[model samples]
Target: MSNNSILLIDPNFDPANSANLSLLVKIGADTFSYVIIDQERKFVHAVYDEQECEDGYEKLKERLKNDTYLNLKYETVKIATHTQNVVYVPQELFNENEIALYTKFFADADSQNIYVQPSLQQNIYTVFSLPYSIEKIVNHNWQQSIKLEQNAGLLELAVQFDKETLIIDFTVGSFQFVYIKNNNIAFNQNYQFEDTEELTYFILLIVNQLNINMKQVAVNVCGIINDGDNKWSLLTQYFDKVEILTLVSDLDTTILDDMPAHYYTSLLALQTCG
Candidate 1:
């Protein structure tokens, strides 16, 4: 990891606990974050770093080579940028050949850079991907791995609660909005924002497009935000019930005493995908 990277390690972390370690690496456009969980599903150590695309991958490779805890039995690689596409296909009608058709939704079908991941949800398949750089780096490290739906972590949050839910996962230059109604995914989209006004505009645009009753739907937010930040205040103007996302009830979060739990919610929820 770079010298500027922010890292947090639980005081109780022990190398002997490697047998139960599970790592999650989330690569985004301008930043990357990772979380390590122990056998008992407790947060062991985590890191969040800001770097250019190529530099971030190089740092990750360096970390993998030197970080003792990363040599664990299980790891999950998640690409969290907007470079990919998400298409819902009926389970019975889906086929490997159709993967190319879905790729066309976001990119040229002939592009070699495209990769597809189909996650089954009852009767539908949520197909998503990792960009070529992300795919190359992750595959080079872990030959056998799973491609997580970009919204999988958010979906985990949505299902755990019984309400019309909207989750906004914020990062450096981008953010993702996920809406769940009646325990099913209604909409999921990512956007780039230059300021709070642009961000608020997009949020209201989605709200109007979805015909969501702002007063009734509960908005749960996560990722790099705080109580009195401009983004938080803007969101409050539209949502009366806006609140930080709740961590999964089972994990031990005592190690996160100094940081807002919402900031690492997505990283922690990634484990639920397993």
Candidate 2:
């Protein structure tokens, strides 16, 4: 495990007999994480999260080579590869034939492995790119074609709550703010922030531009930030219904009782339905 990694595996989990289990993997520029779930029982068997690797890409590939649990056979394998070069196109506007036209907007398009994830419910297609080397590594291990998503777990929040909601998923230096209106994505983008003031400004600007009433909208936050952290503090001051993210599932993940509620939002969102 990396220096600041989090690992939790149930005592009863047996890697040798994982035919009924499901594997969920999340890879990013600086992190690699995976979760094992007993699909039949709706039980969480294992959760391994390692972040902030100095050589994240290389380290994760090495882990994929040596990690015991990761190589096991499972009912299915789902991966979420995070990338900033992503564009959302409405169903009517999406052109599968002209994919290169979309890549023209990305500076590193030539070096990326691109894939599209569609949301039939929302009627939009999320087109994203993953670095060729990393995507190849993922393909080598999973032995299956992978569907990559960038901040798409956030849409699960919109599905969970049928209200005016603003969901912010935070990382070290950036946050992806997704606002849901009329039960679909109205505004979605990532903003770089150095401090609470910068985050506050971005939220205020987006809210005003979208005519979202902070008092009426629900603000659910997750990831690196905590309940009383600077960013969360600032949000509570400006918003009325501010809350940390909760698992949108009925499964009894008793192990999570000791951990912070915000720790696994996007990671677990990879599996759980609204």
Candidate 3:
């Protein structure tokens, strides 16, 4: 194993980390996950979360007392998501400074790689680039041959247009709208909800508030597909061109195991790029 690699630990046993890469080992009360991305190359070196521990920590310690398994050492711990369960590995593994240096290595729509650091946190008081208060939603013309950025295991839905594209973030119960026109952002909206009904209601409310007719819009239902239930069946009743996305043509079909409802949407985004 490379010294510059780290592991992620999960205590909640949430399936969300299943798609994430890096060294994911389920050791009793914790799970480990990690991913190495080449932002410059638009590629990722990821590890699957299928690693297992041969012996329990307590058992390992007891075995070590008897000089059984040897050479076990870990250092440099970090925590992600919930409260205070840390992931530990070698200290020299993954320099934070090196990660920061590659943070700016991103590509533009023209496929030109540029060094730009993403905002670690959004500014609350900053105004939108253009002064149009997006109090309502806007629907532009739709196209089938549109291309979009692939979600690195993130659930994403996008509606492409000639002038702009509307991308929806549906990874969680809440919703976030990001609009890009002429390769520039036009508007953003965020909404929180408790259930799918509220989520659908919020979508309709946004459309009505923005004076956008449902007939002219296309909705993609993603992320929670194979729960042995149909969550998007209701969407067809509201929109004329609703689509349920699946994997791209190039991906292996075996990836369909543990298919989340939004997996189809992720596949659609990948298809756009293809």
True-vs-predicted CA distance for residue 67, candidate 2, Å: 2.5
Local lDDT at 95 for model 2? 92
TM-scores of all predicted structures: 0.81, 0.87, 0.37
- Whose lDDT is greatest here? 2
| TM-score of model 2 (CA atoms) | 0.87
Residue-by-residue lDDT tens digits, candidate 1, 80-190: 433445676655767777676776675423334444443324434566655566567677766665556555676666666667988998875568788877766678777
CA lDDT, candidate 3, residue 229: 42
Write one digit per residue (lDDT tens) for candidate 3, span 116-196: 111112111111110011101000111111211122112222223333444453433444444434433334455556677
lDDT of 2 by residue, 92-146 (tens): 7889998777777764654546677776355567877767777777777776635
Query: Which 10 consecutive positions of candidate 1 have the poorest summed lDDT?
Result: 108-117
Per model, state how many residue pairs clash.
0, 0, 17
Off by over 4 Å in 3: 1-167, 178-186, 225-231, 246-274
Q: What is the C-alpha lDDT of each candidate?
A: 0.67, 0.75, 0.32
What RMSD does each model have against the real structure?
A: 3.6, 2.7, 17.3
Stretches of model 2 off by over 4 angstroms after superposition? 54-56, 111-113, 191-194, 208-211, 272-274
Q: Residue 62 in candidate 3 has what lDDT?
A: 34
lDDT: the better of candidates 1 and 3: 1
